[model samples]
Target: MSLRVQQMLGYTLLSAAFFIGFFHRFAPATFAEPIARTFDVGSTALGGLASMQFWVYTLMQIPAGVIVDRYGIRVPASVGTALVGIGAAVLALAPSFALAMCGPALVGFGMSIVFVSVMKNNAIWFTGQRFGFITGCTLLTAAMGSIASEAPAALLLRISAWQPIFLALSVLSLILAALLASFWRPPPAEDCGQLTARNKKERTKIFGTIRSVIARPQIWLIMLAISGTNGTFYAFAGLWGTPLLVHSFGFERDTAALAMTLSLVPYGLGSLFLGQISDKLRTRKAFIIAASGASTVAWVWLVSAGSATPVVAWICFVLLGLSSSQVVASFAAVKESVPDEATGTALSLVNMGVFLTTAIVQFGYGWLVASAGTGSTITGDLYRIALWLPAAISIAGLLGALKVSETFPREQHQNQPANTQMAIRGQLQPPYRDGD
Candidate 1:
């Protein structure tokens, strides 16, 4: 195959993995009652099920990054994809709560390997500009998975039951995994950076790479923003948004599913919309700050609006979704800040921060809601109080966005010949310059 065709196949398979990762993560939102009934659990217990996925995903972030960089994408990508299929099958046939919980958690472990691996592949195969666009495009695709898990999933549940849907998902994913393992070739040998054996000897010690990323002042600042903005959204939209709508607004389950779908569909579309705009503007910080700031304001309105008409609630949800596109900016910022060689570890650390915050909100927020007497009640007030946490965190995230100072760091490296600049960045820090 031509280099372009090979890279295309690689990314196509990666996108398939990304889609499954998002689908399983958000599937709990629409299936709350089924899950609770099947498992004979309460809100807090159900939240634990969702939390299990993010928590496992969070823990694997650094290790996945290291493994991708230390080994290569091929082995991990194939394994992770197949594991996700297996986990889905387990969920389909799960006979108890314990088994169902194990399913999402196992899927999460597989996903942790998938995302950073795909990102590292992007860094290896594509140029910097293409990388940013692909990042946006990647989120756009993943949001489709989230969307499927919402209203469409509710419709499917009405058709028969949730179990069979997951079973079909299992069969489809295994097929994709087989194709990825068999057909998707690596990037061209000449175009390779960290992906090839050419730079194997120039690799950083594992701890050294970890230290370098964590120690960077800018990375921490950006991560804080990502945690506040994208991280907050994951908690609210991923599992709680539908429940909040039903419990607070008096919408029927199916109606609330549609409203939630309206919200989440934009979350995907806006990534394509705003991400391209960011690319055209050649700025990450400006867009990130604006989007984070806007989303925080929307969140505040949602919490304070108090028992509005369902239409008003739907509008608020859509605004929140559109503004959540700032997440793409976070992805771009992290990718640009590091050398291509360290993209996996760097991006994975940032992902760890986001998922870590999501896990806390999933588990901790449920506990808080339960303790406050709103856990199973239909009181909007309690949900509003519970929402205060993510709103406050988003504020902190916007403040952190102000500290990230890069238009496009990776573009400069692109201008230099691969041998001279890419090699030097792998071994030593580039000359201490502005904002790096």
Candidate 2:
């Protein structure tokens, strides 16, 4: 088969892997209450469970990056899929809450390997210029997975038990894992050869690659932006948004779920469209600033407007979705700033920071909401209070955008010579530059 065909097939299969991987993480949103009820645990305990998952992710990020760079994605990803499958099965059979925690913890440890590995592979396969759009599309894929867990998963749970739902997921996960192991190929041998330097002075250790990311001031800024964007969204989406809507607007759970789904649908679409625009425009900062700024405004309006018409709520939700995917800028900025040698590490570091903030913010948002009381009058007030959080984080991140000096230049890397611009597994591999 042609290299392009092979690369496309590989990416498609990887995307499927991503879908299942994310489904396991976000599936908790739909199952949280049920699991808690069955186990006699509270929301706080559930948050602790989720935190354990993130902690595994935090610990695994750099190691996973190194694994991706050295072994390619196949080994780590196949292991991760098997872990997730096993974890899901264990959670399904759990007779107690403690046993259930084992399932997500194992799954989280496994996911830590898969997420960075897939993203690093994408960065290697595609050029920096396309990172924003592709990353955005990837985020959109995760969002769709989140959406499925929210409504569709709930539907399944109504007809059957959560155990059955997880069983089906495990089967799907196993099939994808097998497909990835069978078809997943890395970048071309030439590209891998390029990574090896004949002289000792020319080569840096893997730890050096990670240190390079840590040394960059701008990387932290990008992390801040991503953290704020993700933290606010995930924190609110699963726990508080439904209650806030129902309490404030008198909407039913089904209506609230539909509204939440509507809110996220735009994000998936926006990521793809905005990503393409970013690639064409060759400008990153303006998009990041505009998207975050719009989202900040939307949050403020949501706080002050009270429940108002359902139409108004839907509009605000869509705006939030559109702005959330603007995180493509964070991914694009990292790709633009880092050298190809260190790209995997840099992106994984960014992912670590983003998710760390997400896990924390998710807990904080819930605590703040509950502390304010669930009384009718308190719902809108509590929402207003909550709205400021993501806004503040986003605004701080905008300053990070100011620090990024790199831009996706109009000149195509394809115009460069074959040696400098090698094709990887049939696709063009972008040349390494520290910053430009």
Which of the numbered candidates is closest to the native, going by highest TM-score? 1
lDDT by residue for model 2 (344-406), tens? 677778888877766766677767767876553365567556666666766776565555555
**lDDT of each candidate versus the true structure:** 0.79, 0.70
Q: Stretches of candidate 2 above 4 Å error?
A: 191-193, 196-204, 374-380, 409-436
| Sequence-dependent TM-score of model 1 | 0.92
Please write out the lDDT profile of model 1 over residues 173-277, one tens digit for every residue: 788788888877766666674447643753657777788778777678778888887787788778887777877777887788788788887889888877777
Clashing pairs in 2: none
- Can you give the lDDT of residue 430 in candidate 1? 43
Instruction: In model 2, state the lDDT of residue 368.
Output: 72
